[model samples]
Structures are given as C-alpha cells and as structure tokens.
Target: MRTAYCVDTVRAAERDLMARLPEGALMQRAAAGLAAACADLVGRVYGRRVVLLVGSGDNGGDALYAGARLARRGAGVTAVQLAPGRTHAGGLAALRRAGGRTVAPEDAAGPIRRADLVLDGIVGIGGRGGLREDAARLAALADGSRAAVVAVDLPSGVEADTGEVRGAAVRADLTVTFGTHKPGLLVDPAREYAGSVRLVDIGLDLPGEPDLEALQHADVTRLLPVPGAESDKYRRGVVGIAAGSARYPGAAVLAVAGALRGGAGAVRYVGPAGHAVLARYPETLVSDQGPERAGRVQAWVVGPGAGDDAGTVAQVLASDVPVLIDADGLRLADVGAVRGRTAPTLMTPHAGEAAALLGVSREEVEAGRLAAVRELAGRYGAAVLLKGATTVVAGAGGGGVVRVNPTGTAWLATAGSGDVLSGLSGSLLAAGLSAVDAGSVGAYLHGLAGRFAAVGAPVGAHEVAEAVAGAWRDVVRG
Candidate 1:
C-alpha cells in the first residue's frame, strides 16, 4: 500500500526524530536529497543557472542549503529570499561561502526568468488558505518561465491535508517530498499541480495507522475472494440486484454484466426488467417477486436506473443483509431508514447526487471533495464512496482515514459506467468483505478494467465490465 499521513502526524514524527539526532543533521539529509534530484533534473550541475525561491521557515533553509551544495559543484546559483531579515543564518552563510549570491525580491525577476531550474520552497505543508500577495506574484513569474520547476515538500498555495487549491500556486514538473506522502500529494486539484512525486526517507518513524491509504497490487490480492475446493455455490454467497425500469432496460443488462464477474457465486435479479436481463445474461437467476420474496442473498444492490422507485428502495433497506445504494436509490431512499440500519450500507454517488444528499450545490462538493465525502458518511451513518476523477471512500465513523482510488482513466466518465461500478461493489459485499474494503477494492478493479478496455479508444460500460476478470488476474498473479 502507498500510505499518506496528515500534516500533524508528520510534524510529530519529525520532532521525535530531530530530538534524537544531532543539531542540523535532519536538514542536512533533506538538503542532500533535494540537491541530488535538482542535479538530475538539470542533467548537469556544472555552469547551470539555478534559482531558489527562499522563504522564512525551515522549508526555505532547505532550499538555501541545497543551493549551497549546487554552488560548490561549479553551478551559478542564486537565492531569492522572500524573508530577508528572518532567513536562516546558517543556511545563508553556507550559500555565500560556497559562492551563491542572495538577491532581493525586486531583483529576482531577471534571474528567475533566465534560470535553468527553479526550486520552490516558498511554502510548506503547514501553510493554509492562499498565497500572500508577494508570493502570488513570484508564483505567477514561475508560471510564465520556461525552466523545469521542482517543489520542496509540496506545491505552494494548496491545502496539504485537504488537496484544496485556494488561489495562485506553483505548478511543478516534479515534487521531492520527505519522510511520508502528504494527503495533498495523492489527491487533486493539488495532485494536478504536483506533476510527479518522489519520496525521500529522512528516518522519521511514524506510529499507528496512516491518515489515508491507496492500495497497490499486493493489497488487492489479499482482499480478493477465492473459492476453495470445499466451497459450494451457496457457501460462496449470493448477490441480489434490484435495478432497471421499463423505460431503461439497458441498465439491468450492464449491471448484470458487472456482477457476473464480481466473484459472487450467483446473481439474483429482482426487478421489472427480468426479460431484458435474461436476454443478455442467461446465467442470471431472474425474479419479479421483489427483494424480500427473492431467495436468500448475502447482499443487495439497489437503484441504478430504477427510475425514482422509492418503494423498491424502502423494501431493500428493510432487509437484514448488507446493501449498496446507487443512482435513483441515492435520491429516493429514506434518510431515517438508512441511518437506522444495523446492516452495512454503502452509498456510491457522483458530485450531483452527493450535493443533493448534503443539501449543497454541486460546485461546493467538487471544490471540497474530501470534506464533503466525510460529512456525508457522518450524517447518514453509512460508508460513502464519492466518485470523480479521484474516487474517495469514507467509512461510517467520522475522522478516520479516507481511502483514495488512484487507478482510473478519463474514459470512465462515459454513461452507465457508474451503474457497472455499483453492481461490482455490491457483489463484493455479498462475498464477505466489510463495506469499506468492498468499496475500495471494487473501485480499484473497476479502474484498472476501464484502462484495459479503453486502450486509447472509447469504451462502453459493458466492455469495462468484461475486462474485470483480466484486472483480477493481473492483481492475483502479481
């Protein structure tokens, strides 16, 4: 797993390590790593013109020390200090001794414009809101430059913990982060600013669980449900799907296509579109008796083009099995009934649906996705999966780490793709995983499948569903 901790946790870890080490030792280690990455980025350090955007804190000191290292290697380096009087005394002296000059903000435009590489150390992870006026001006200058930019820790003018871009920020070609990954580095719109990320170890030991996590192939393999020799179809678990309307029967076909490959033993389709489902997938067990009268199922997937059927949503919510709500079900389900459920409820909502549930505009949810998803989970007492370019999953309990899915392609924005995802996740719920696990793993597979299906062309929802087995095998074999 690729793990990320919030700013407070990283600060605590840094303090503990700094206490045991000698004075200035940690900064030296950080500077060494930064200098090396800068050297590689510029292709050569000798005779190269480098400019450092130095600020007030240790984040600036890191840039200054790194500049000093570059100066000693025959590079012409200059430091543009944002805070002249408050600059790190040790770092400033080192840079001057090594033949690097310090320039005021007024004289920085020429050097910044002519630089081979620009290092951004103006703001660190603890920075909040937007960039200050002078910093914003410097950011704009960098934005207009041709130099390859490298950011220290994270890009400026972004919420390091929330991935929110408040105002003007530096767009870097690469970011060199220390210790562990920050939440912003792994998410967007900050992630969009951070082109590529590389982590440097400074030996800060973090304790307990991380604040967020992104699962890799090894993690997905462990979560996959594999049938044993002793396991029968009934023992494996059954998934019941209540979906589709007379008006839109293609939804039932697409959802069934996903569930058939979702590792469930059997798929029981209970809805008005039974004929449409059987025509496409003859393997499905068709039923018109509603969810309650349908034979025993370990879990239920409701909504997904049921066309505003609140009665079907209420009936499924009253069941003893775990349930996943999507599409029309997200809008039509009773808030009281959902909050009172003893069984697990996983809700998958796009930005518009999430906005409706939270009583906010769609723009608000898009702007602060991390906060919105967590708030929805807290209010409804259910696991929530907010789908977009970055798919985030939040567990029912408030304040725990939210899982981010990092494997999707832009082609996943097509119609009926969400319906396929809902059915896939619900089937995993029947296969005995918790709501959080099912949602995250399902998203992981769904994304990889989309990539495989699209392969530089437009892929429909049914094609994405068909590629799930290939993604499953890739994870398991690796």
Candidate 2:
C-alpha cells in the first residue's frame, strides 16, 4: 500500500533527518535526485534550454542546486528570480559558478517562451491559498509555454494538506516530491495539478499513521476473499441488494450483475424491478417481499434507483448486518438511525450527493473532496466513499487514514456505474471485509474493470460490471 503523510508529519520527519545529517547534505541529496530526474525527462540535456523559477524558499534552493548540476552537464540553464534579494545565496552562487545565468521576473518571458524545460520552484509545500500576483503571472506564463513543466516538491499554489487549489496554481507534466508523498499529491484537485509524480526519497522516516493510504495490487490481492474447498453458497456469504424502482429497472439488473461477480456466494435481490433482474440474471434470488423479510443476508445494498422507498431503506438500516447505502437510498436514509446502528455502515456518494448531505454546494464538495469525505463520514458515523476523479474512502467516526483509490479511467464516468459499485462493495461487505476495506477494494476492482472495459474507448456500466471478474483474476495472478 502507498501511504501519504500530512505536512506537519513530513516537516517533523524532515527536521529530525536534517538535524542528524551534515549541514547541506540533505539538500545536496535532494538536488542530485532532482537533477537526475530532470536529465531523464529532458533526454540529451546538452544544449537544451532549462528555466528554473526560483523563489525565497528551500524549493528555490533545490532548483538552483539542480540547475547548477545540469549546467555542468552542458545544459544552458537560467534561473528566473521571483525574489532576487531573498533567494538562496549559496545556491545562486553555485549556479553562477556552473555557468547558469540569472534573469529577473520581468525579463523571464522570452527565456520561458523558448525553454525546453521549466522547473516550478516558485513555492514550497508550506504555501497556502494561491500564488501572489507576480508569481501568478509566472505560473500563467509557464502554462502558456510549450515546455514540459516539472514541479519541485508539489505544484505551487495548492493547499499541501487539503488538496484545494483556491487560485492560480502551476500545472506540471511531472512532480519530483521529496521524502514522503504529501496528502496534496495523492488527493485531487492538487493531484491533478501534480501530473505523474516521481518520489525522490530524501530519507526522512515519517512516524505514526498516514493521513491517507492507497492500495496496490499486492494489498488488494491479500484482501480479496478466496473460498476454501469446503465452502458452500451460504458459507461464502450472501449479499442482499434492495434497489431499483418501477421507472428504472436497469439499475436493479446492473446492481445484481455486479453483486454476482463480487465474490459473494449468492445474491438476494428484493425490489420492484425483480422481473427485470430475474430476466437478466436468473441466478439471483429474487423476492417480492420487503428487505426485512428477504431472509438471511450477510450484507445489504440499499438505494440505487430506490425512488421514494424510505420504508425499505429504514428496514435495511435496522438490520444487524453491515449495510451499504447509495444513490436514492442516501436521500431516504436517516442520519440518527444510521449513527445508531451497531453494525458497520458505508455511504457512497458522488460530489453532488455529498454536497447535499453536508448542506453545502456541489462546488464545495468537489473543491475539497478530502475534507468533504471525512466530514460526511463523521456526520453519519459511517464509512464514506466519495466517488469522483479520485475516489476516497473514509472510515467511521471520521479520524482514521482515508483510503484513496488510484486506479480509474475518465471513461468510467457513465450512467449506472455507481449502482454497479454499490453492489460490488456490498458483496465484499458480506464476504466479511470491514466497511473501509470493502469500499476501497471494491473501488480498486471497479476502477481496474473500467480501464479494462474501456481500453481508451467509451464503455457502458454493464460492460464495466462484466469486467470485474477479469479485474479480480488479474489481481490474483499478480
């Protein structure tokens, strides 16, 4: 699993490491790695034009030292000084000694326009809100340029802790982060700004639990439920899906389709769309009765196209088994009842739904997804899966490390896709994973399946659901 630490944790680690190391040793190590990464990106660095946006922080020092290394290797490197007087004096002198020239911010446009590469060292990890007016202009110029932009640490103008890009920010083709991955580098919209991150370890040992964790293939494989030879249908666990309405029967079919492939022993579906579900998947245990009378099920998936079905939602929520609430069920479910449940509860909401639940605008949720997910989880006393560009799962009571799903394709954005996710996660819940694990693992598989199904083309939600088994097999094989 990939883990990310908050700024305070990272700073503490860095300070401790720096104290133990010789003066300037840590910076040199960082500079060397930065230079090496830059060399690899700008292949055949000799005679290439390199522009470094130097500021008044350690990030500027890193860029200057790296620029000096590049200059020694025949690149015509130039530093654009954002704060001339306050720049790292030693780094500036070192760059000058290595034949790098310096340019004022006012004189940077011409060089930036013709540069082969741009290093964004304008701000460090501690920078809050957005860039200053002068720095914003430089960021704008960098965006307008054709050069492959590489951000030092993280992209400038992003909230290091929250992943919120309030104002002008640098957009990099790659980001070379030091020590550990920052929470901003893993969460969006800061994640979006930091394209293709490359971690250049500076050897700081971070302590305690991470702010966020992202599951890899190995981790997901370990968590995947595999039945033994003696396992039976009931033993494997049954998932009950209480979804769909008379108006949207496809939601029921799609949900059942996902549940069937979700490693559950059996699927029991009870809703108005029983006929549609049975027509598509006869293996499903269909019922006309309410969720309370649907017999035994290890887990229940409520909502999807459950239009105005508050009664069923309440019935499912009252069950002692773990429950997953999604789509229309999210709307009908009671907060107090959800909080009072003794069993694990997982709530999956897109940015819009999350916004509504939080009594905020959709823009607020999308802009600060990490905060939104954590907040919702705390409010409901349930695990929250906030679905979007970067799907994040926060555990109940709001304070555990949030799990971020790294695998996904933009093509996964389609109708009924979330309904499929609800079923898949519900099945995992029945299979005995914790609410957070079920949500994260289900998201991982769902994302991989979307990638496999799309393969650069548009894909239907049903197609994504069909590809889950393939995703599962791939994980196991790896």
Candidate 3:
C-alpha cells in the first residue's frame, strides 16, 4: 500500500528527526537525494544549463545546494532569487563559491527561458494558496519554456494538506518529494500539477496510520475471494441484484454483467427487467417477485435503474444481509432506515447524489471530496463510496484513513459505469470482504477494467464489464 501524510504529520516527523541529528544534517541529506534525482532526470550533470528558483526557506536552500553540486560538475547553474534579500545565506555562499551565478527576479527570466532544466523551490509545504505575483510569473515562464521543470517537495501554489490548487501553480515534469508522500501528491487538483512523483527518502521516522492509503495489486489479491475444492455454489456466496425498470432495462443487464465476474457462485437478479438480464446473461437466476420472495442471498445490490422504488429500497435495507445502495436507491431510500439497519450498508453516490443528501451543491461536494465522503459516512453510520476521478472509500462512523483508488481513466465517466461498480462491489461484500475492503478492491478492479476497455478511444460500459475478469487475472497473476 502507498500511504500519504498530511503537512502537519510530516512537519512533526521532520522536527523529531531534526532534533536528534547534528546541525544541518537533515538539509544535507535532503539535498543529496534531490541532486541525485536531478542528475537522473537530466541524464547528465556536465555542461547542462540549470536554473533554480530560490525562495526564503529550506526548500530554496535545497535547490541552491543542488545547483552548487551541478555547477561543480561543469554545468552552468543560475539561482534566481524569488525573495532577493531573504535567500539562504549559507546556501548562496556555497553556490557562489562553486561557479554558480545569482540573478534577480527581472534578470532571471532570460536564463529560465533558455535553460535545459528548471527546479521550482519558490514555495514549500507551509506556503498556502497560489503563488505570489513574482513567483506566478516565473511559473508561467517555466511552463511555456522547453525546460524539464522539476518541483522540490511540491508544486508551488498548491496546498500540501488538502490538494486544493487555488490560483496559479507550477506544473512540473517531476516532483522530488522528501521524507514521505504528501496527501496533495496522491489526490486530485494538486495531483494533476505534480506530473510524476519521485520520493527521496531522507530517513524521517513517521509512525502511526497515514492520512490516506491506496491499494496495490498485492493488496487487492489478498482481499479477493478465491474458493477451495470444498466450496459450493452457495458456499462461495450468492449476490442478489435488484435493479432496472421497464423504462430502463439496460441498467439491470449492466449490473448483472458486473456481478457475473465478481467471484460470486451465483447471481440472483430480481426486478422488472428480468427478461432483459436473462437475455444478456442466461446464467442469472431471474425473479419478478419482490425482494422478500426473491430467495436467499448473501448480499443485496439495489437501485441502479429502479426508478423511485421506495418499497424495494426499504425491503432490502430491512434484510439482515449486507446491502449496497446506488442510483435511484441512493435518492429514494430513507436515511433513518439506512442508519437504523443492523446489517452493513454501503452507500455509493456520485457528487450529485451526495450533494442532494447533504443539501449542498454538486460543485461543493466535488471541491471537497474528502470532507464530503467523511460527512456522508458519519451521517448515515454506514460505509460510503464517493465515486469520481478519485474514488474514495470511508468505513462507517468515519475517523480513519480513507482509501483512494489510484487506477482509473477519465473515460470511466460514461453512463452505466456506476451500475457496474455497484454490482461488482456488492459481490465482493457477499464474498466476505468488509464494506471498506469490498469498495476499495471493486473500485481498483473497475478502474483497471475501464482503462483496458477504453484504451485510447471511447468504449461501451458493457466492454468494461467484460474486461473485469482480465483485470482480476492481471491482479492475481501479479
């Protein structure tokens, strides 16, 4: 698992590490790693034109010292002072002694424009909001140039804690982060600014749970349900899907498609679109009766295309089995019934549904995804899966690291995708994974399948459903 820490956690860790070490020990360790990454990025240090954006902090000192290293190796290195009078004195003197040159903010543009590489050290994690006027202009210049822009720690003008990118920000080809991964580097908004991240370990002891967590193939593999020789159809787990209406039969078909590949022994589908589901997948056990008479199931996935079916939502929620609520179910289900349930409840909602539940706008939920998901989980006292570019899964009652899915494509925004996700995750729940595990693993598979289905062009949601097994194989085989 790849973990991310917030700014405060990183600061606290850095302080603890710094206190035990000698003076300037931590800075030197960080600078050494930064210089090595720069050498690797440029492919060579000798005779290259390198421009460093220096500010008034340790980040600037890091860049200056790294520039000094490059200068001694026959590269023409220039340090541009963003804060002219307040630059690191020791770093500046070292750079000057090693044939490195210093330039003011006005004169810096020329070298930055023509340089082969640019290192952004204008702002560190402590700096909030966007870049200042002078820094923003330099950022723009670096972006427009052909230089391979590398940001130190994080991109200037991005919040390292919450990943909120305000005004102007530097977009880097690579961001060499010190110590551990920052929350901003792993999430969206600010994540987009950080092109490819390279972590440079400077040996800081960071204990305790991380602020955010992302699963790898191995993590998902361990969570996946694999049957033994003694396992039977019922023993392997059965997933019941209550979806689709007469008006929209495709929803049921899509959901069943996802459930079929979800490691479940059997898929029992109950809804008005039974014919549609059976036509597409003959293996499904179809039923037209209400959920109470739909036979036994280990878990239930409701909604999708069941338009305003309050009775069905209520019936499933009252069951003693795990339930996944999506689409119309998310809208029509009673909040009190969901909260009052003894069985585990997994609420899957896009920004719009989540906004409606919270009485806020879609923009608000999208802007603050972490906070919105946490609030939703706490409000309903159930596991909440907020689906979007960054699919976040939070367990019931909040207060833990929210799992963020790393694999996905923008093409996943297509219709019927959410239905597929709901069915797949519900099957995992039936297969004996907890709400959080089921949601995160299902999301990981669904995203990888979407990428496989779409490739470079647009593809149908059915293709995505078909590709789930390939994704499953890829994860397990790894």
Against the correct fold, how does model 1 do in TM-score? 0.97
What is candidate 2's lDDT per residue for 55-160, written digit by digit as tens?
9999999999999999999999999999999999989999999999999999999999999999999999999989999999998998999999999999999988
**Candidate order (lDDT):** 2, 3, 1
- The candidate scoring highest on TM-score is 2
Question: Residue 371 lDDT in model 3?
Answer: 83
Model 1 lDDT per residue over 1-478, tens place: 9889999999999999999999999999999999999998888889999899988988898989999999999999999989999998899999999999989988889998998989999998999988898888887888789888899999988888999998888899999999999999887778888888889999989998987899999999999899999998778889999999998788888878888888889999999999989998999999998888999999999999999788889999999899999999999998899999999999999999999999999988887888999999999999999999889999995468899998989998999999899889988999998999999999999999999999989999999999999999998988
* Per-residue lDDT of 39 in model 3: 91
Candidate 1: C-alpha lDDT = 0.91
Q: What lDDT, from 0 to 1, does candidate 3 have?
A: 0.91
Question: Order of candidates by TM-score, top first?
Answer: 2, 3, 1
TM-score of each candidate? Answer: 0.97, 0.99, 0.97
lDDT for each residue of candidate 3 in 1-478, tens digit (9 for 90 to 100) = 8898988889999999999999888888888888888899999889899999999988999999888888888889999998878998888988999999999989987999889999999999998888989999999999999899999999998888777787899999999999898988887778889999999889988889998999999999999999999999889899999999988899999999998889889999999998888889999999888899999999999999999788999999999999999999999999899999999999999999999999999988876778888999999999999998888899998769989999989999999999999999999989998999999999999999999999988978899999999999999998
The best candidate by lDDT is 2
Superior by TM-score: candidate 1 or candidate 3: 3
Instruction: Give the Cα lDDT of each candidate.
Output: 0.91, 0.94, 0.91
- Cα RMSD of predicted structure 2: 0.7
Clashes of each: 0, 0, 0
Please tell me which model should have the higher lDDT, number 2 or number 3: 2
